[model samples]
Target: MRCQTCGDATSPEHHECQRCYTPLGQPAVTPGLPTYRVRGIGLAANVAVGATAVLYLVVALYPLIGMVMARRAMANDDPDLLVSALIISAVVALIMTVAQLTAAVLVIIWTWRARKNTDAFPGAEPAFGPGWAIAGWLVPFANFVVPARVVAGVARDSLWRRATPPLVAVWWCSWLVFSIGERLATRADDRAYEKLAETPFDDAGYQAYVDHYQDALLRNTVPALGCVIAAVTLILLIQRISAAQEARIAHATPQWPTAPIWPAQVWPAAQPASGVQSAPGAQSASGVPGVQPAAAAQPLSEVPGAAPAS
Candidate 1:
């Protein structure tokens, strides 16, 4: 028989799956609860996240490109090309932001559905309810840890009695690192740009502005790299959880027998052999020979010591 949780083949004699340790023939916690399928949404979230990561890499390289542009503008005495480059960078940044938002929405939806599915699995015990899947990401200071817990809970419950994938920790850590680094980088860039705008148009001022911009770009590379690692790990984690849930659903489904194991048969009551017959004097009113019915009792007055009837 195949283990429901992990889809591994196991001996029918065993009480649990050797690969994942899930109990054999375990019944669902709620017998008739519905389960939501997350495989399709997971795939879409993976694609969106992959695109966001690629965009982050491109954005990280923007600083180096900006520095080259600055140098070329100074040499050729032309600012128009530099302005165009800045506009292109802004456009790319906008696109990256949209991709990030799309990815976030898709992932949250998938998480919510996955959490709901745990009710149909026997050993699943989610730490939070389905609502937390979305609310965890919205809470201010708690967002960092709550969202991680929500995902971790889903993974644990989905693969009940099995070790959760390590990718969950890796992805959460990298995501947190990227979030913090990106914020810091954005603040630094804003300060540098404000100072650059205030500086008088002179040789020293231009050089200072270029240096500041290049430094900001270099700092962004850290978050960009983190984003890539988080995205890849998240994709793998989603695949693992989705497959486990699918296997569990298949196992929990009831399989009806196509035919009865022993079909019932009926026979007519037994009869005497072909030539048999009852003798002429054997039959009587009671259907037996040499037997007499009991006589009715005599009246009570007939007894010597009996009192007369009232």
Candidate 2:
């Protein structure tokens, strides 16, 4: 094996170089800087988004439940059932609104984390988290287009910079379109309800209200589907980037050998005495007492009647 510090051949069992004596696997001389726990933040954000989205599902679907209850109330002429359903439906809508806002907040955090994590990567850009811009979706008039464009721009950045995949672009774009459609459908349903309220004494307009309610229900599904697709894409992109980075780091680092053996020079064992006298300088400097030698410590091969050492 070779010593990493001195770049010289070394025995496998030694931690220090034989020539320079420098310590070979000591920690980095300069302490490594701490990095943001980007993976953990992303995981938390994903969890929050998932939970909020589930709450949104319940809230968003409440109106349909309300519609069903309202129809039952109308057919049976039960004012109590009608009032109860209306209140429940209204509360659920309010909850859904809150969940959507919360999800938007989480998405912003996710975007910021993504940018921060990518900062140290080779060829990284100067973009901040997209969460700052996605907040525009919560705005009334601006929500119609700005949010979608912001997502598209981020997605584009991800692809061009190799920050994320092309599928992310598609997913965010679909989400933006669906979000706008859902808002419009919701407004239409609200307006229909208002119109129905104004003609409270007439039962003839109930069908129109039901139709608008169904439209909102169907329109909301688009955004839900888009969210599901986006979530899946995000998971895949994160895994790929993370794995690539890990492999690169591992490959760049040096590895040490694990064996305990050494390769020092080897010498043959001395032969036993042949009851013959040795010539001058026949024995080694740190002489073995019982060993016989050749004439003047001649090589073992030339020694007479000195069978090779067992």
Candidate 3:
């Protein structure tokens, strides 16, 4: 039913809306988990994503700086300064990686809970279930498709409608672009690292390879830009979806069906109910067996005070 106060859909089992806290009625059914909890989780996840994304921007700039500094080094620049900067960048990158992983986990949790609340909503019929939240992110080739689909579904459901989630699409595209760029940069850097270890810096070929390494580092800026966009977009999208769920919850009424009531069986009592008795051959309302109805009767001739039959 639609919430009378806000016109948002909700289950009758809920005493109040998970979003607006608007009272619907007496508990009629078991409602889905609370929306406030999902909101809290989303907020925390956003903080993590936002902070990590900012640091990522720093990480991205370091490579560009490194590439430039390498050129200076080849021109008889201060190698010690370059070495110190790289060491510090590496340490920062390690910290960012750890933080990013933690944030990603929190985001998954938020998605799962959001999907659950949507499913519980009065008119909701989401396309995906909770498991998709994790599976979409972890699957190999399918990861690209599933994660977007799952996120889209949650956002769409939050609106309590079937329209495409435009923000979701935008955020996803940014994320995809960022992922590809980061991968390419990392792969190139790894190759360079292995080659450098094999061939000493003083080798004749090392000078030529340095140019190629600089180019690889320069290439990373594009993806790093994408990462910043994706991070900002992601945080906004999360907040928007949470608000949508709350609005939907506010207008909704409990959709749960009324529980069935069963008749109670009264046990046989020592005395007839209401000090009254049933007439002869009447069926007892209590439905007990082996109990005869109470009534007054004349004594039989077999008894000491018996009255003879007329």
Candidate 4:
């Protein structure tokens, strides 16, 4: 068999890889998971990713509308009309933002599940422990680095530790850069809106707000584009990883016809002791094997070396 860690060819009879000493035949935490069920997670994640990608595409273009509106407001085309446009834009942005966040959450959940499923096999040794997949994205400063590392590790392990997925770096870089841009732009946007609130309809006072709004809209495009690319790349990575795991599990195991074997026993039926005298020529009434009648099964009553009746 090929060693998972060291890529060494070794005799199949050995329990550990000769080159790297990695243990073989280790039991899975979730044994007997069906392929279709495991694949279902990937399918669900892909759906979320596809939805996110489409929404991100909308997000990318949605900014253009905002930029145009801001420009119109700056030109003082119509104060009431621009105010109404801003309200409408705000509502649409809120709904889409909620949707995008939901999709992102779904992606994380499914990806984490997929990584866990890979652990059902020995060859797929993900670098990060499973919790980081979720927590990596939640922790404040650590999130920026941890999530990317976790993804890279899972991507490599999913491929049988053979090669890293090509787009993983791209996905991580774009995601981080876009996130930074989004945060900065949001702060600027808030300040811009605060200024606009100070003078609801004054054209001369609106220029700063209009400029900042335009900047925010344009800035959002960075993350939106990143979201689109990351979603697509991630969908592919998930599909690849899940497929590899399915193949590995099928090849590494053949368990459908097997039965569970208990590790030890207790509460066994009582048995007759050796050398107790039984009525001459009598046998046990029950059909149990190797158990003589009580009379011939007394415990330690006979001499240790004494001959017994034939």
Best by TM-score: 1
Give the per-residue lDDT of model 3 (tens digit) for 12-95: 678765543445742221265455447788899999998889888877767666656555665654455456545887898898
Per-candidate TM-score against the hidden true structure: 0.74, 0.55, 0.65, 0.64
How well is each residue in 1-310 modelled by candidate 1, as lDDT tens digits?
6765566787878887676556686653347798887889999999999999999888888888888777766666566656766788899989999999999999999989888888666656678888998999998988989888888877887765455557789999999989999989888887777776442355565566578767977889889888988999999888888988877777667888798676444322343343333333443334445322222123446645767767
Give the distance in Å from residue 235's predicted Cα in candidate 3 to where it truly belongs: 1.0
Off by over 4 Å in 1: 1-25, 28-30, 160-164, 198-200, 254-310
- Model 3 segments more than 4 A misplaced: 1-36, 67-82, 196-213, 247-310
lDDT of 4 at 150: 76
Clashes of each: 0, 1, 12, 9
The candidate with the higher TM-score, 1 or 4, is 1
Go through the candidates in order and give each one's C-alpha lDDT. 0.76, 0.53, 0.69, 0.64
What is the C-alpha lDDT profile of model 2 across 111-144, one tens digit per residue? 5554443333333344434453645556687665
